[model samples]
Target chain A: MENQAQRSPKRRISKDHWTAIAFLIPSFILILVFVYGFIGWTGYVSLSNYNSLVPDFSFAGLKNYIYLFNDFRFQADLRNTVFFTILFIGLVIVLGMGLAILIDQKLKGESIFRNILLFPMALSFIVTGVVWQWLLNPSTGFNQFLSVFGIQPKWYTDTTILAGFEWGSIEFGLPVAIIAVVIAAVWQMTGFSLAMYLAGLRGIPEELREAARMDGASEFQVYLKVVLPMLMPITMSVVIIMAHISLKIFDLIYAMTGSGANFVTDVPGVYMFETTFRGNYYANGAAIAIIMLLLVAIFIVPYLWSSRKGDK
Target chain B: MAAFPIGKLIKYIILIFFAIIFIMPIYVILVTSLKPLDEVSLATMWTLPSAIDFSSYVEAFSKLAPNFMNSIYLVVPATLLSALLGAMNGYVLSKWKFKGANTIFTIILFGMFIPYQSILIPLIQFLRTIDLYNTIPGLVLVHVVYGLPITTLMFRNFYASIPDSMIESAKIDGASFLGIFRHIIIPLSITGFVVVAIWQFTNIWNEFLFAVTITTSDQQPVMVALQNLSGSQIVQWNVQMAGALLAALPTLLVYIFAGKYFVRGLLAGSVKG
Candidate 1:
């Protein structure tokens, strides 16, 4: 190949180059149209007055955004999403790391426990939502069973707000109803963070632990000072990934508790879906989507940039 | 490595507790599905059914049967087409390096991160324009298109592990690009195909947003159908649980039999990318 390339570099370059281009062309076109192109179109729709059943592409110019910011449902969505993302990511990290540590103890039936934990990751959020819905039903399901123990709680229907404080056009506090959704989200995603942390735990050399022990560090001290620091990068990845999933969460919330009592579990993704399809508020939905994209971008772009830099 | 007996017991207790927490919902679903409708109350959620009943499965299966078939039709072809496209893209991007190839790869990779909601409005419009709206083929096209980024990333990373000299040698034998991909790349990447296929199959099978939005009732996938089974005013807990299980069975089976590969796919899809 080297000798032939030297003999006729031009012919080889053109033929191979075209072939490479040919192979890439289909994907390129599809991605360009579907991903990039559709995003552009969505951006356009967000700026237009394309509300109602009929398509009206007249210039709206941030009107929809302004309306959504003022709208009560959208405001509640923003608040719910913020609290959900924090609580969901926090719980997933803690539970995931704890489980990783426990499983890393070289216990019996490690694969059984790992597989059981990770199996939830295999099911759709839709299925997870359904099962969780039944389990968390305020009147039936676990409530009935738990009532025997003198414990009765409105699982997802609980709309009590904690740390309640008034903010500009929205209540800035944790909506308690989100806890059920958070539990469901954490259950499904803990496996992902667990897998990551487990791999991170395994990658840390045993010699380091021995070294820590030789320095008179206790087991917990070694974990805190050495192992924890080593797992920082994995934790960052987990946070970003979990944050992204939480920000765009739809299926579980949609299936489990549709908007909850008084929209306590309402999220931007659900609101966007309902507005676009059910209410025929196309432009409003587009605005919600663009906001979601921006939110996801804030988490993802930096990660992608750093990963690209690492690649070089 | 030895701990106090008390500490070891505590560890076992904690592990068992979480294991129960994780498994309880599944257990409830299983037991609930097997109970007769009259006995399917939340109070009996933990009880053994007096008699095993397959009636719920029969009812759920008959209702979900069409949608289940839709998921199969959607998953198989979508997986194959995307994997094929990804292999070709991966081969070229990794082995047949070109000017600005890295830029192109990065651009495509960006597709993986964009929230799908951001594009749905225009995606529906585009589908309607192409006359594939509300059809199985339309959903397939959407899945293939949206699936391209991750699939390409997986295959590219996989093919990168293949030494470039293999391609160079194939070239030396007067093989064209297609010839090399067909013989050298395809044969070498069977495991790659399996990984990508499993990833895509589970994903497409379990995907809800596109399945719900793109196709109406008759064309709906099982995931959407499963959601619908519980949408009525009067809920049948047994049938709903049965439907949920039936819907989840394929992916669950995949995770059970080929869990290692599934985890590999997850790691490859996330950790590397």
Candidate 2:
């Protein structure tokens, strides 16, 4: 009887562990094959000489990467992505933080205002793109409305490089045409940062603010020092999240502007799509994909690292 | 206290100004969508339609009808399957802790941050190899795989809130693993399921990159179809606006009714990650 009791408990525990692992097995296999396995395959393809529609797995060194780095369209895409990221992140933070503060003032019809601001977030970026495409049409849409104020500037069609300079066969300047695309992006994503900032603001204890007030700090001082510093973590989260979205932005740009005049608004994501599917430059596209992955990794890997450490 | 009214007034002015900027595009689209073909012009953009018109909607709906169905067929099964798989994975990771469970989770969660563009080439090649290219099932599989990281994180965090003691007590009763899950976990996770469902539904519905890449003409989801609608020559502003509204209606309704859950899911997904 004693032997049976001990054996039964051990077997039950093993059985439980086995079942638990069994539950994870399906997800494990799928993620392994789909995420990690496919990533490895892409890395290999990036290093190969497979430029056609056919799958030639024969190896070539970093030649494809070199070719892309020297390519004008790719260079333009790099420049556009850099400018877009800077402008998009800058505007989203400003607008989102600004709106959050405005709403936090305990305005009347708070939910109504909040809903209106956030409603855009619900629509797909494609829809946002289509809507904004029409609105920012230089000849029509918002241009006509703005003409009443005498501000009729070419929107997406404008390819003038502001503060233009050249470096290593790439123009290092803001493409004015990308600004229209940026506006649409900022409009769609500002709600996210707004919500995050509002949450972060709400999380601050009233006692902290009251204590600051008792110390004779002005309202601006309180926000500048206490509230903004307190919101740093949320801001980091917002930046990393927005950076990922911006780096891989496709649909909005694709629908809003197709590679723009002079490829001014072209991004790597759209470039990769067209190059691979439209142009059938498969190897070149793979190299672009790898470079994008490396850029995202630079931002996200460290984030995951720090966040994991924080969790511990 | 005496300065309060002026402060409040200034606050209202700022709020109203920003609100107007935020609502302008939506207002333009709404009005433009309602305008008849000839009335849809730059000058009339800010003006309300002279008369309510449904003809643009009629035209857009007929054009977009097939792709709209495609989106439905794609989103429903994809959401359910991903959520179910996430629930299962969450049950194991949280309730049934094992060696390297956290490590395994961190690995899976890392998948969420991948730009996905990185994997497109191989993903396409693999799908073609498997003969699933240009099919809805192929897109569904891609979504489910990519969605695992976020949904797993969601359900795991959710299940963590359910005390481990419940599972311990159930285990002490000689209930098997499946029994404990079927009896205890599933019943308790109805709200978790709802939140995950809403998140996945919105995401998969709004998703364009995968849908655009994975599916071709007939199999294209509504977002891609919407893009195609505008891509053709001689763009009809009224019809296009109406098509945009039609494409947005389902998710817009979800946001309207379940805005609370949507926000909750967003917070949970981002904050936890």
Clashes of each: 0, 0
lDDT digits (tens) for residues B1-273 of candidate 2: 456588788888888887898898878778888888878776667788889998899999999999999999999999999999999999999887666788788889888888787888888878999999999999899999999999999999899899877887787799889998899999999999999999999999999988988899999999999999998777687889899999999999999999878877887788863
Residue pairs of candidate 1 with colliding backbone atoms: none
lDDT of each residue in B131-197, candidate 1, tens digit only: 9989999999999998998999999899989988788777878998888888989999999998999
User: TM-score of every model?
Assistant: 0.95, 0.95
Chain B TM-score (each prediction, in order): 0.95, 0.96
Q: For this target, which candidate reaches the highest lDDT against the unseen true structure?
A: 1
Candidate 1, residue B16: the lDDT equals: 87
Measured against the true chain A, the candidates' chain A TM-scores are 0.93, 0.94
Q: Interface RMSD for every prediction, one decimal?
A: 1.3, 1.3
Complex DockQ, candidate 2 = 0.76
Per-residue error (Å), model 2, residue B133: 1.5
- Candidate 1: tens digits of C-alpha lDDT, residues A148-237: 899988879998888978876767799998999999988899999989999999999999999999999999999999999999999998
